[model samples]
Target chain A: MVSKDELKKLAGLARVELPDSEIDSFRKDIESVLDYVRQIQEVAVGDISEQPQGVYGLMKNRMRTDENPHPGGEFSEEILNQAPQKEGRHFRVKKIL
Target chain B: MSINLEKLTITSAHRHLSNGDFSVEELVGACFKNIEDKNPKLNAFLEVFGDWKEEVKKAQKLFNEGGATELTGIPLAIKDNILIKGKIASAGSKILENYRAVYDATAIAKLKKHQSIFIGRSNMDEFAMGSSTENSAYGPSKNPIDPERVPGGSSGGSAVAVSMGGALASLGSETGGSVRQPAAFCGLLGLKPTYGRISRYGLIALGSSLDQIGPFAKSVADLEIVFNAIKGEDSFDATTLSEPGGLVLPKKLVVGIPRDLLSNPGINQEVIENFEKSVEKLTDLGFEIRDISLPNAAHSLAVYYIIMPAEVSSNLARFDGVRYGFHKTGDDLIDEYVKTRSSGFGREPRRRIILGTYVLSTGYYDAFYNKANLMRNLIIADFEKVFESGVHLVATPTTPTEAFKLGEKANDPLAMYMSDLLTAPANVAGIPAISIPSGFSKNNLPLGLQFIAPAFREDVLFSASRKFLDE
Candidate 1:
């Protein structure tokens, strides 16, 4: 079983608050998935490769020229309007310090 | 409504529109009538678009101007995950409850060019997390066939929209089996194209490496038309591939069945029987059938679980109450982030994020995440080998059985996750797969058979699916 303390720490790292009531049930639910997925450890995969690619084969990620096609701030008005809290042209956030 | 929306496929609708047998507005109104009549109990749409009239007007003008395409004025339900500019895309999670899109997804952009009407955004599992729509924040979407049962998800509402005749088709996104599993349960045709085949620019990311937007319809041919409109190169999503030149298929194509994987006792006997009948039916279609080995496939589910969540943890980090979306305040900035996200996300997404953090944590990184990635490569290689031996596509039951009763697996996360077991491998391999309606279970519910084609080979899937269903 994943210890409650351990799950608490994981929730913190994941940026989620784990209410005390859910600790036990959540741990069990998470562990069940983990236990099921642990079967991959039994499979034999010999030598590990330095680089990995998924089924779709391609080279390095593509990059475009440093250019903005739709003049700057085209979508800025609509985007800024959605901010839950906002200041002049910026998203307002809670104090860092 | 005079028209039976369920009986009209895209081709027949196109013919009718061109022949002036019925106007696009009449067809669209019939669809809205179905939505009005059926959506009350089905809960297929989260919000039916108010702009459909404006869209319908443009489509009618296209027909009058003789500029209509096959998809012109066709009504489609958009899954909440795919963005349509200036519209709210909640993704069935509380975190994005009021968030609206600022730009259009590449797929939506492609469809818009054809003047396809957006019916509205449909419901889905939170962050596309769960296999059943029970995880949807709004509420579970009922199966059209049986209200007591689930419409397998996280594309449940999109599936229900087509199954209930609310929309002629729908656009759904998938990370692992979200499109195909639900299509199977709802008896609709669902296609998940190869990763990079459809651009993911405006999609709400679940797993960046595994996600793709797919189409759902009643007929394979309709699905193909919708697919062709949206697929191809896009500068917005760097992962997207350029359109390939013509693919010349062999006169004879071979299909491989991974019987060893299918024979698991966990699979429903009725589903197994139906799968066998589908196999036999394929033999009658003049295609060569062979039993093939995919030794590493058994590990694919585990690999998918690991890699998917690890990516999920990374991808979902953006919703920290800083910019747009649902937010809450706390003692400090970090606390604010935690509190906002904790309350913003539902149970399933929160659980996945935490599970993801554990696997990618410092001490466990090498053991879990790295091992899964290595195993994923082996799984992908296994498909490569089978295809190298001249297998055109791989076949399997889309799910273990038909849709189960609502709340049957809701409490047990493991059981809910297991519903996606057979379909997840294709996502792990980044391959294209389609679920075609195969017959029904004794419950009179729909069942499906899936065919997986190699990466970037959606052509094979479309052809095979059409041939199978047509026969």
Candidate 2:
């Protein structure tokens, strides 16, 4: 079973705030899920490796001469408008340090 | 009301629109009426675009001008995850509750070129996380077939929209059975095209590598039409193929059945019976049914859970409250991200995100994430070996069972994960799969018959599914 500290660390890394009430439940959920997925460890790792095709593998790198037919900024204004906190042309956020 | 849209498939709706038997306005009106009547109880639609009549008027003009495609005036429901520029696309999450799309998804753009009228965005599991739509921040979309039961989800609303006649057809994205399982539950035809067969340019990223936008229709033929319209290469999505690969129907339809996997204790008895009946039906149609073994097929769910969450963790990291989505004030950046995500994402997505982060963390990465991918390669090889031998298509029950009651598996993440067991292998292997209504379960809920064809072999899937439907 995973310890509470490990779950807390995971929540922090995942950037999700696990409420105290739910931390215990999540710990159990994660434990069961981890136990289920633990079977992957038993499978022999050979030369084969893959990335999910729908996400990445099927896409081949297509090289082309750099030409600006349609500039990237076409939807810049629209995209910026979606920002929760924006300053003029940029998205505003809390301080990093 | 006189048109009886519940029986009107997209093809017939197009025929009526072309023949002038009914105007596009009347068809649109009929659909709206159905939505008004059924949507209140079913909760299928998140928002029915208010200006749909304007688009219908444009379609009417096109019909009058004599330049209209088969989908010209057809009203279709789009899953909330897909973007329609300037429309509120919440993706059934509270975080994006007020978020508006800046651009149309590539699939939506393709459909627009064919003049398919946008009906509305349907409800989905928040960020397409749950097997059932129960996790929707909006509310669970009830199955139109049986209101007390869930419309199998994350695309539950899309399936229900078509099943309930709110739209002629609908589109849903699937990262592990989001489309197919719901299509099965709602008794509609749902297809998950080969991974890159349809571009994922504008889809709300869930598990990016596993996500594919597919269509739900009343029939396989209609599903094929929608697939053709939405599929093809898109420069915006580097994953898409330049063109869909051609499919050659085998001289004789040989359907492979994995008996070992089917006999697993997790599957319901009635579902197994229904699967057998479907196999017998194929046999009666003179399609050779052969027992095939996929040694790693049982492990697909495990592999899927690992990879899907890892991808989900990475893909969803974009919604950190800086650019768009729900934001909360915090003392610092760390607190802001945590607070925003904690509030924005629902329980299911958070659970998966945490699981994903755990697996991808140092020390655990090789034991879980890397091992899962290696097993994924093995699973893909398993399918390749079977298909390369003689099987034109592999068959399974789309889900282990029919639609459960609204809250049946809501709290148990593992149970919900099991709902996609049969459907995940196709996504993992990057193959095309479809779920067509097989029959009703003992409880009178819908059951789906799933067919998975080798990579990019949608033609074979269509041909085989069409034949099954006709028989």
Candidate 3:
């Protein structure tokens, strides 16, 4: 079972502050989910040679050299106007510096 | 009028459009009428597209000019997570309650090229996280067949829309049985194409590696049309293969049946009986059916929960209130991020995000995330071994049971997750799977038989599914 302290640490990592009441519930909920995942440990993987890579490897060699300057056409300024915060032409966000 | 144009397949609709029997505007109006009358009970659409009238007008003009594209004038619904420029793509999350999409998903762009009419956006589990649409912040979608039951989700609304004839077809994204399970419940054809077959350029990320954009239709032929229209390589999505090499099915198709997997206690007796009947029918129709062993198949749901939530935690990191979505006003940005997400995301999303974060944390990554990936490779290898044995397709019941009552599994997330056990294997293996309406339960609710083909072998699935439909 997942402990309350572990749940709190997970919440911290996720950057969400849970209420006092929710911590216990979340611990139980998460533990149940993990218990379900414990079943995967039983699957024997003795003969598998190649790791399950995603589609990236399958299509990596098929790359195209021709980069169309604008394949589907440029986004209109009106579209950019919809951004929550805009500075000149680009979307603005919180300071990371 | 004799054709019940609402029920017409994509092929038939194209013929009618070419013959000038009906216009795109008329068809769009019919879809709107259906949504108006049925959406209230089904809770299918969160928001209908405002520009549908103008879109319909453009499609009608294009059709009249005799230069109609493949899906031209076809009314289609889009799952809420896929961006459709200048519309809300909330993914049924309150966090994105006011967020508007700034661009169209690549699939939507392809549909636009064909002049397909956008009817509305369908509801889903928040951030595509849950099996039942009950997780939607908006509310649950009731199965059209039986209002008391769930329409099986996160693509529940899309399935219901097509099942009840609200939209001619819909585009639904599946990470783990989202599309197929719901389609099975609603008695429509839902195909989860091979990962990367369709670009995920503007689809809201769920599990990036597993998520695939696919179509929901009343018939198999319609599914093929939509699949063909939306598939092809896109510069935006580098993962898409250059349209897989071969398209034809082998003369003697070998279908694998994991008899032991289906014999689990969790499977409903009626569903098992129906599956047996389906295998019998297939055997009589000249296709070879063999019992195959996938000993590790039971581990699929567990593996999926780990990998999907891990991806969810990473993907959702972008939704810090300062950038986009519903922001809970606060003195500082950090506080704002915490407050907004805490209140914005529903319980399930928060639970998953937290769980995912824990699994990927410093000390636990190897034991949880890495091990899950290793097991995923083994599951894919299991399929490979079966395929080497000449099994072109694998078949099973999409869900162990037909649509259960709306609130039956709502409170129990584990019970709900178990519903996806049979379907998750295909997603984890990255193979193409289609759920077609098999037969009805004793109560007359639809049951779907799932057909899974090897990666990039959608053509084989289409052929087998089409044959099943014909029979």
Candidate 4:
């Protein structure tokens, strides 16, 4: 089971701040959810299969070579005008780099 | 002859349009009139498009030019999550209250190509996260049949729009039972085609592998028409399968029934009786009815809760408020990201996101996400084994019960989640499933029976559904 401190650490990692009053409620909820998940861990398996079967196994490489690559110049100014925030020639963003 | 355009099925509208009995303008005008009259009470629409007059003119011109497609000039509502250029695609979240789509979704592009008239954008649970539209940050969509009752959601608005005659048909996306359950509640036909059958490009991601865009209509035939038009390979969505052409029905179909799985205590007696009657009608029509056991069916909801939230955590990670949507310009980068998501997303979205993040976290990944995926494989294998037994179609109640009163199950998330128990397994297995109006409940509300077919066997599903509707 995940401890309350571990849960708090997870909340910090996810950038969410739980209120002091609701922390206990959230702890119970998270513990119950984790308990439900722990049911999955109890199942015993001998030789685990590597290649996934069914829908997940149906994943195929979806690359396309038939279409020619278009140049960046093809994008119209009218198209660029739709951005929520744009600099002079490019889509603008806050300083993260 | 002035008829309620909202009440008329697409097939009837097509007949009238072809006979020159009614012009496209008249039809579009009637729908707009219906929306103006009904939307205030129903709250089905988020925003009615401003350029509808020009769109109506274009559709009329296309009809006059003899270039009208099957859905030409037909007015439809779109679920807010599917992008339609220049319209607010909020997905019922305050975070994206002002977000406008720069491009049309692939499905919307197809509809536009056919000159279909778009009426408006419909409401949904915030970010398509909840079973009840009550979770919508805007407001809950009231049931058209009974205003005091809920229109089962997150596709509640789309279903109500079709049910209440606001639009001839509407587009809705299904992650779990979003389409079928609401369609059942509203007495409309809803189809959740096999995953990847319709392109998801431009659709705000919910659960990537599980999400599918579908149609809600008054009849099985109308659903087929819209499905045929929007279904095909798209360059933007590589997952879409090539159009396999029209599917033909077999001489005799074997219908599978997981009777034990459906014997839930919460299920209404009337729903069970109606399902049995429908099965009997199918049997009388020479279709073979076989009792089958899908014991693992009970575990579908548990499996879905684990897998879906994990995907939700990943898909919604993009909405950190840096690129688009609600962004709080804080003192620093960390503050901005933290403040934005904390205030932007609703309670349900936050709860699921946190739960999802926890499940996919390093120490918990193998125990939760990985096990869920393995169980998902087992569920698919179960369906494959049933199909191998020569079962052409599987039948179950679309929902356990009819529409409950508004706010009845809203507080208990687990109770609301249980409502999708019958519908989620098909999604987990990635198969074609549909819900058609079965009969009225004891309260006079509608009941729906869902029929599912193996992957790429939409033809069989359609044929069987048509038969059931005819019977």
Candidate 5:
């Protein structure tokens, strides 16, 4: 089982607040999922290149001229309206420090 | 109940509208009437658009002007995840409850050009996280076919919209089984095209790699029309592929059935029987069928769970409180992110984010995420090998069983994940797959038979699905 401390740390990294009540259950859930996925370890990877699958075949490099101008935003006003706290065109955030 | 809109398919509706048998207004009225009567019981639509008439007016002008596409004036329910500019796209989560879209999804933009009317934003599993719509912050969408049961999700409400005739078809997004599972349970045709087959811009990302916008309709013909309209490359989504040239299926196509995978003990006997019957029907239709083994298929679900959440965490990181979406104030910016997200996301998404963070976190990255990526290769290789050996399509049951009761698997995350087992492999392999309505189970609930083709082979899926429907 993943320790409760580990779950808390994970929740912090994920930017989610894990209530004390959910720590045990989350640990159990994470552990079981890890257990299920552990089957991947059974297959010997050998000297095979670790470049991952499904990425290369689906994507290809399609370069565009750098000189081309980016599409100017027509949605700034609408987007700003959705922000919970905004001043003028900029979204307002709490102090970083 | 005055009109049986449920019996009307888009093909027949188009013919009627074109022949001047009924006006677009009448068609739209009939759909709204169905929504008024059925949506109360079904909970399919989160909010039915009041501006449907105005949109249809434009479509009617197109018809008056002449040379209208087949989808002109077709009413479609948009899944909450797919954006329609200036509309609420909550993605069934509290985080996005009041968040309106600033731009249209590529699919929505394309459909608008065809004069398709947006009926409403349909409900879904929060952030497309759960297999059942029970995870929606709003509430579960009831199955139109069986009100007591769930409409399999995260495309549950979109499926219900079509099933109840609330819309002729719906645009639903899928990361794994969201579109197909719901279509199977609701007895509609659902198609998940190849990964890059459709642009993902304006879609609320679940797993960037696995997600694709798909269509759910009453017939394969309607599915094809909708797909043609919404598919192709977009400047916004770099991952999208340019239109693959059209394909023609061979006269005698050989379909492979991964016998070992289908024979898993978890699959209900009724589902197995229905799947076998579907295979037999295909054989009788003059298609060749063979028992094939996907040796690495067993690890697909595990790999999917790993990769999906990892990508999901990364993709969803954009939803911080500052830019847009739900916000909560705290002493510091870090606390604000934590509180806002914790409050905004529902149980399932929160769980996934944490799980995702764990897998991609330092010290564990190589073990979980890397291993899973490597396994994805083996799984893809298995499909490539099968397709190389004369397999035109791979067939399976869309799900292990028909729709279960709402809340049946809610508490058990593992059980909920199992609901997507058969459907996830196609997304993993980045292939096009469709779920076509098969015979019903003993419980009288609908079932679906799934067919997967090689990447960009949507034509093969369409042909096979159409042929199966004909049979």
Candidate 6:
């Protein structure tokens, strides 16, 4: 079972706030999920080999053209337009100092 | 002319469009008309596109120029996760509620070349985190088959859009059973192609290794057409298969049924009975049915839960308040991230993120993430071992049971996670799997029998599904 402190740590680690109201409920659900999936830890894999994951395991060294595909700043405006706060060309964040 | 949208298949639509039975505008208009009527009731589409008229003009031009592909003027629902340039793709979350796509997803680009019309962005479980659309930030999409029950998700709304005649076919993504389960519930064919088969360039990533954009349609050929259109190595997606290779075909089509994995009490008896009938059908169609052993098969869902969330945690780390989307002012910068994310994301997304962080955290990584990856390696090897024994495909019920009531498993995270029991194995192995609507349950809810093939062997799934459906 996930403890309250552990749950808070997880939330902090994941960069999401664990509001006081949601802590207990999130803990209960996450604990249940962890307990369920923890069965994998006991699945004796002594006889098995851990192959590298995915397409890269089977095939590699694939390459593409070196030339840049898109023009510089082609989507800079479109991307910047979505920023919550932005200057002319930079995404503006609150002052750090 | 009113289009019988429910019965319209891509092949039929193409013939009719070529024969001048109806104009592209009429087809697109009829789709809009149906969506307008159904979406309000079903809560299927999150947002309908407004520029379908422009797409109609392009399709008509293709037709007039005698260069029309089979998909020209075909209206399709795109899952909210796929980015279509100049349109909003929320992925059924409030954080990105107003996040407009600046570029088209590779699948959308391919479909656009064939002049395919995107009807709208359909709803889904936020961040593709849950089995039911109840976790959607907007709302859950009601099942067209039975309004009270869930249309299996996170591709639920895409299935509903197709089932309710909003679109002739739709595109969905699968990390677990997202696409196939909903397709099963909606009485449609759905496919989860080999991972990397479809480019992930524009898909909102959940589990990067497990996620693959797939299609849902009423007919097998339609599903195949959609798959062929979107699948191929992409320069943008590094994981896509490098070589265009021929599908592995056996001299005699042999299907392996791992009976051990299906014996769980969680699997409904009705699903088992229907699966037996499908086996008989496969036998009748000249497939050699063999009972086989996949030692690591039962560990699929457990392995998937560990692996998927880890990737989700990493993949979703980019959603800070500064760049785009909903932002919240907090005490400081770090506080800003915590507040924006906690407020922006829904309960389910937060829970998964926490769990992913937990598993990937230093102390627990060896127990959970490492074992899960090793178990995944074993699962992959088991499938390879079976195919080596001359078993061309693996068979199982697409889901454990028929679609359940809207909130049946809402309170129980464990029960909801069980939805992916059968389908998760394919995703784990990065193989091709298709869900064919086998028959209906006792309550008249639809059921699907799935056939999973070796990596890049979607050809086997397509031909087998066609024969099974007798299309």
Q: Give me the candidate number with maximum lDDT.
A: 6
Candidate 4 vs 6: which has more DockQ:
6
TM-score of chain A of 3: 0.65
Worst 10 residues of 2 chain B by lDDT: B242-251
lDDT of 1 at B100: 91
Best by DockQ: 1
lDDT of 3 by residue, B403-435 (tens): 999788877788889999899999998889999
What level of docking quality does candidate 5 show? Answer: medium
Cα lDDT of model 6 by residue, B1-471, tens digit? 558999999999999999889989999888889988888989999988898888899998888879999899999999999999999998999999999999999999999999999999999999887777989999899999899999989999999999999999999999998999999988999999998788999999999889999999999889989988998888888888854556455566899999989997999999999999999999999999999988888999999999999998998899998998899999888899999998999988888888899899989999999899889988888898998888888999999999999999999888999999999999998888999899999999999999999878888888788778888
TM-score of 5: 0.97
Q: Candidate 1's residue-wise lDDT over B59-168, tens digit each? A: 98999897899999998999999999999999999999999999999999999999999998999999899887899999999999999999989999999999988889
- lDDT (10s digit) by residue, model 2, range B1-471: 269877898788888888899998998888899999999999999998998777888889999998899899898999999999989999899999999988889999999988888889999999999888999999999988788999998899999998899899999999999999999998889999988889898899988778999999998779988999989988888888865445456779899999877977999999999999999999998899999999898899999999899998898898899989999989898889989999899888899899999889999998888888788888888888898889999999999988999888877889889998899999887888999989998788889999999887888888888889892
**TM-scores for candidates 1 onward, in order:** 0.98, 0.97, 0.94, 0.94, 0.97, 0.98
- Candidate 3: tens digits of C-alpha lDDT, residues A1-97: 8778778877877878878988877777788888878776665667555454544347564556777567442665655555556677675555645
> Between the candidate structures 2 and 4, which one is better when assessed by lDDT?
2
DockQ-based class of model 4: acceptable
**Candidate 4: stretches off by over 4 Å:** A1-3, A21-25, A28-52, A66-86, A90-97, B243-248
Q: What C-alpha lDDT values do all the predictions have?
A: 0.89, 0.88, 0.85, 0.84, 0.88, 0.90
Per-residue lDDT of candidate 4, residues B89-149 (tens digit) = 9999988888878789999999999889898999999988877799999899999889999
Candidate 2 lDDT, A11-61, residue by residue in tens:
888899888999999988888888888987887757775554333455688
**Candidate 3 chain A: worst-modelled 10 consecutive residues by lDDT:** A48-57
Worst 10 residues of 5 chain B by lDDT: B1-10
Clashing pairs in 5: none
Model 3, TM vs. native: 0.94
Question: i-RMS, every candidate?
Answer: 1.5, 2.6, 2.9, 2.7, 1.8, 1.7
lDDT of 5 at B241: 81
